[model samples]
Target: MKRLLPLLAVFAPAPAFAHAFLKSAEPSVGAVVATPPAQLLLTYTEGLEVPFCTVTVAGPDGAQVQTAKPQPVPGHENELAVPMHITAPGKYVVTWHALSQDTHKTQGSFSFTVSP
Candidate 1:
């Protein structure tokens, strides 16, 4: 039993060092909205280090559309928002990199559309 206990401990999950994975978004992944969104909101599976995280939005033409850097949502430690200035009707790609409070890093990208 003692030998097995050590082995189990070695294989146990490390919840304290988990990455901050994307849990949801405002416009949502692959959503089609009639109007452009004023901002992009992202929720993560864990709290983020706001200063070490970044979210970027690019228009269909490949130009950057986000007006500013990502900021943490008030009172929400696991959420971040990016102000947007998009007008054209097309697909927009949002990419994000997160550094969790425990120092684990994660990143991913998704796209949404603005219909004319």
Candidate 2:
């Protein structure tokens, strides 16, 4: 039994290192602004696969804005940028989903407001 215990420990599954998270943003979370930002930027903790990752923006009325597709920033695997065209807004939510190099997927969201 003692010899078998040692073998079992060796075969035990290790904990998975989860995909990266949103470390920060440009306008910042829950920020209120007088005018809309020309571009939105998101920074993550680890590199993300561009093909399987996406960032979306929704207006205060829960309607999605026709924003530009997310693009990877130069020399930074953990940063992404998206263009914006916000007309009228009260609260805007930014949602993101990303897949890591290990094929694990993760998602999260944040919101900010545009003052009238």
Candidate 3:
């Protein structure tokens, strides 16, 4: 029983190491929209450290599109948003790096099309 108790203590904090993952997005992954979205919003499974996170948008031509730095959505620590200007109609790739409040880091990318 003494050995079992020590083992349990070591695993008890495993959940605290959980990494944040993309929960959803505004234009959503693989979405085809008729009009260009004015902003990109990303939601994560856990609260993020906005100052240590980043989100980037690549335009249809593969150039980095101009966008405001990602900001935490007001009143929502797990949600981040960036205002973007998109004029062309094509696929845009969004890549993000997230640092969770607990300090775990994660990253992912997805593309969406603007048909307008």
Candidate 4:
């Protein structure tokens, strides 16, 4: 039994470390809304490098949406947001890349719909 226990210990999962994990989004990732949002918001699980974070928004037509640079909230390094110019009701794709204070890089994308 001791031998089995030692072997099992070697295969056990390692402890998790901090990373800039996408915890949630303002549009709620894959949500459909009745109106277009004037901005994009992303919350991470760890403090992020504001200068290294980036966000890109695109419409279903494949043209990029005019968005201001992403900025971390003043008191919340884990949150990022950008001003968006939403014109019409349609699908919008939001893509973001983040660099945590620990130097870990993470990225993801999702789409949401805007209906009148």
Candidate 5:
């Protein structure tokens, strides 16, 4: 019985980790696009805690770009769409922070270039 108890405890199913991680992004990481994307699209590995998530866009000179608040993509709680603007040819950096429904938080940054 003692052996069984210890064995059961050791082999018990573990809780699954549900951290929100960037799965993929539009304008793709380090991509050079002929046209600037109207919005930044981010897909995450888990459903997000919308109120706790944020996305920011910055221009080549590290100036903040005016952007609308991030919102859940229609029919997709795991995706957030953030409106952005890039008026001239330059590199843009996007930084995002997400809090998953599991309460885990994750943040990351990536850059993309706009060509003339």
Candidate 6:
């Protein structure tokens, strides 16, 4: 019974490590489209604390196209939207970094193609 008590104590707080993950996106990744999207949206599995997220768009030639800042969606703690102004036709990569409510930082990238 003594050994079992120690094992139970160790497993008591095992649920605190649940990490956040990307849940969805607007103009979804790898999507090919004919027109430029007004904004880029990213949704997370969990709510962010500070909501300091950034999204950068790079054109096919590796040149940045959009410079607008990312804005957090009102009433939605796990979603963010960033304005876009894509001028060239090619592959564009959207990279994002966000801090979760637990003070853990997460980042990832996705790509989409703009038809010429």
Which residue pairs collide, candidate 1?
Answer: none
Model 3 stretches with alpha carbons more than 4 Å out: 1-13
Q: Model 3: which residue pairs collide? A: none
Candidate 5 Cα misplacement greater than 4 A, ranges: 1-13
Q: Which lDDT tens digits does candidate 6 get at residues 1-116? A: 88899889987876565555678888798999899888888888888753476678888888876667778788998888888888888899988888877777889999999899
Comparing candidate 3 with candidate 4, which one achieves the higher lDDT?
A: 3
For every candidate in turn, the CA RMSD to the true structure comes to: 4.1, 5.1, 3.6, 6.2, 3.9, 4.5
lDDT of 2: 0.84
The weakest ten consecutive residues by lDDT in model 1 span 12-21
Q: For every model in order, what is the number of clashing pairs?
A: 0, 0, 0, 0, 0, 0
Ranking by lDDT: 1, 3, 5, 4, 2, 6
Tell me the tens digit of each residue's lDDT in model 1 across 1-116. Answer: 77899899999988864789999999999999998999999999999999999889999999999998998888999999999999799999999999999899999999999998
lDDT by residue (tens digit), candidate 2, 8-116:
9999888465577888997788999888888888888788887788889999788877377888899998888888888996898999898876677889999888898
Lowest summed-lDDT stretch of 10 residues in model 4? 63-72
TM-score for model 5? 0.84
Overall local distance difference test of candidate 6? 0.81
Error of 2 at 3 (Å): 24
What C-alpha lDDT values do all the predictions have? 0.94, 0.84, 0.90, 0.87, 0.88, 0.81
Per residue, candidate 5 scores C-alpha lDDT tens digits across 1-116 of: 77799899899888576789899999899999999788989999999988789989898888877378888887899999888877878998889999999888999999889898
lDDT of 6 at 89: 82
Error of 1 at 36 (Å): 0.3
State model 1's lDDT.
Answer: 0.94
- Tell how far residue 54 is off in model 5, in angstroms: 0.8
Model 4's number of clashes is 0
